[model samples]
Target: MDLNQILAQLETANDEEIKSLLQQYNRENSHTFSFEKRKKACAKLCQSVLTVLGRQVQPSCQKTCLETLRILSRDKSVLAPVATRKGILGEDTQSEEEERVVVEALKCLCNVVYNSPAAQQVSVDVQLANGLCASLRNAREWHHEVGLFTLRLLFLLSALIPDLRGSLRREWRAVRLLREVLEHTLDVRWVGPYEAARPDPQALPMPAEDNERAMEVLKALFNLTLSDPGGEDDHQFRLIAALLRHLLMLKTETEEKQRKHTGDKSIQNRF
Candidate 1:
């Protein structure tokens, strides 16, 4: 169906129709669309999707709406303003109802943050990083997808909004958490007195979950240390850098190795 048909159907669409229309993106995303198409889709469907989410829909339907928005958010132009104005990024990211919904929302959020430089400025204005940090702190335990996406969002904020790094480090002490997460996720047992001694591992099977989370934490730390290390962070930087060194030394995943683990575990996680 075309955009107009999709929008028209969405207007009166019940749970299944809404899901079917939204699910189109699952395949469409694998191909590229023009800017005009994505912009048009975002302009027309942002409110449509949000309205569906606001209704007392079934958890399954709400999940689809959020997932669709997450996919569409790659447009990052029209969706950014509409999403921000709707208070999407500024709102409590952890959904009250369902964990999957929260994960989808966070993915949508990461897209908006990563794809739009304008969104970065808007996020800084709305103190989006502060909100993300608060949520990250509240999540003392890793809720897998939720925690992973939260770290990814924070990493995007740190990398995209250059001005926000110092505050993330000093104001939020975000570096400490990044350090802790990287260490815990990678089973990086520091050998020496402090982080000055980095992880040195031989053969390790990086769990899919740990691999993704550690990558995000590393990215955030790398972004924070882009400049000369501040006096307060010199030691921490050394430790994080050591972790990076260890990751780099990790043996490449052979083609056979990659083929072995090419299962549907990640696909199952979406639901």
Candidate 2:
């Protein structure tokens, strides 16, 4: 029941044992495992979990470790080390397992920044914004899900720290990357895999998940604009155009679906 003992056990634990320890650590809400005991071991435990995350471990074990980090990130003392870790943003050519670890790391970072001012300060002090922007820029070639999680993290950071918006807007590459994603979404058509053989020029369908990811990018851009109004004039125009185009495409797709379902061509061309 001692937190230090748990930390020592976790250090040498196998995947199954690691998962068990993490689950028990996550559930330590009783008076026996008091807040003082947790605070005493929080940093060491978080460091151990982060070390595990850096290893070539099983995806499930990595996930459990990340879940533990997510919980520990609520403590201000743990945020700095977690945010400053080098390998948290897996390499561009990472395997699927590595990519999942990166996504979970981003999610853990997002939780760290959500409503914790201490964590926010640690993030800014450690230059976490630059790291997140790097992830966004590199994501063009990395896994799509990596980009999605990066955007989500940026959105949360911008929302939590008002000053971040100005800094992000000044990062021209990040702004440009968001614009490119929006433009791609505008060209997407909602078609399935079986229907992709013909390759319609005017209607190239993107996976629905891609569209959702693009929307997350847009949301981040919108959040940035709310605090930093001096986005480049050309980039601003492109963002607006891309948003309008995406909305029109969404409307057209919705109408097509309604027409097919209800057998009514005149389903209110209203938008």
Candidate 3:
């Protein structure tokens, strides 16, 4: 469809239809759209919506459309301008509306990594880390949530990048940094009507669930390296070996616990 037709649809279509159309447009036309075209389209579409709807309530359908823009960002054609958008970059002048776009963009980026074929083909783990690092480095105080969400998603995507030499060092450090930041932001509580807003200090905490997820990412990275066993990448091999040792230690503890639990169950049965 022509640009006019597409823009018209974006303005008036039902939420589901709008989402579908946006995705289709992003996927099919991304390669073909000129740089100027993609830039203008993104800026215009995002601006128009923010003007009309504001940011308080993000409709599910609009969420999908925003995600489609994120998918589009995978293309250099689309990514450069969006990343460099006056609003997305410098923190000094970032408004809440701009921050909303950044957050929505990250949500889309996460969805792409977790659910899209594009992520599989695009080395999402590395690229996602880079994107989030940039966001965290650039975020303003009001947009701290955006940085937090990006960090959370990076923590998840770490599961998919295979371990490489010196990989553990960087990966673990990143997780540690994220945990520290989450801890620093720790005012969210689980009581009362704010239950949904409660922070899982465990997953985002040191010596807690965050450590577990970090271990998971480490294991996944190690597995990826092991799966392709070739002439050894010495540093990777050493890192993997270290992680394996740590895992074995945990496994021993797990087995002992299971044995104890089983024995407790047998005693109950006799009673």
TM-scores for candidates 1 onward, in order: 0.77, 0.64, 0.36
Runs with alpha carbons beyond 4 Å of true place in candidate 1 = 24-30, 35-38, 80-83, 90-96, 138-140, 195-204, 241-271
Order of candidate numbers by lDDT, starting with the best: 1, 2, 3
Rank order by TM-score, top first?
1, 2, 3
Q: How many residue pairs clash in each candidate?
A: 0, 0, 1
Question: Is candidate 1 or 2 superior in TM-score?
Answer: 1
Q: Which candidate is the best by lDDT?
A: 1
Candidate 2 residues 148-244, lDDT tens each?
7778877787778887777777754566667666656555343442111223548645455665676677567666655335436454544454344
Candidate 3's displacement at residue 224, Å, is 14
Q: Residue 117 deviation, candidate 3, in Å?
A: 3.9
Clashes of 3: 1
Tens digit per residue, CA lDDT, model 3, 1-271:
5555667776666656666766666676646534455676755654443332332334554455565555554444434323323323221122234556557755555544554444533533334455554544443343454654565556545555544223433543343343234323332232432122333424422333333333334333433333333344443444333333322223212454434323333212211
Quantify all predictions' global Cα lDDT against the true fold: 0.68, 0.61, 0.43
Residue 97 C-alpha lDDT in model 1 = 70
Residue 207, candidate 1: Cα error in Å is 2.8
Q: Encode model 1's per-residue lDDT on 68-185: one tens digit a residue.
A: 6666666655574445645464224335478887787788788877777776777787787787777766655758999888988898898877889989888987887677777666
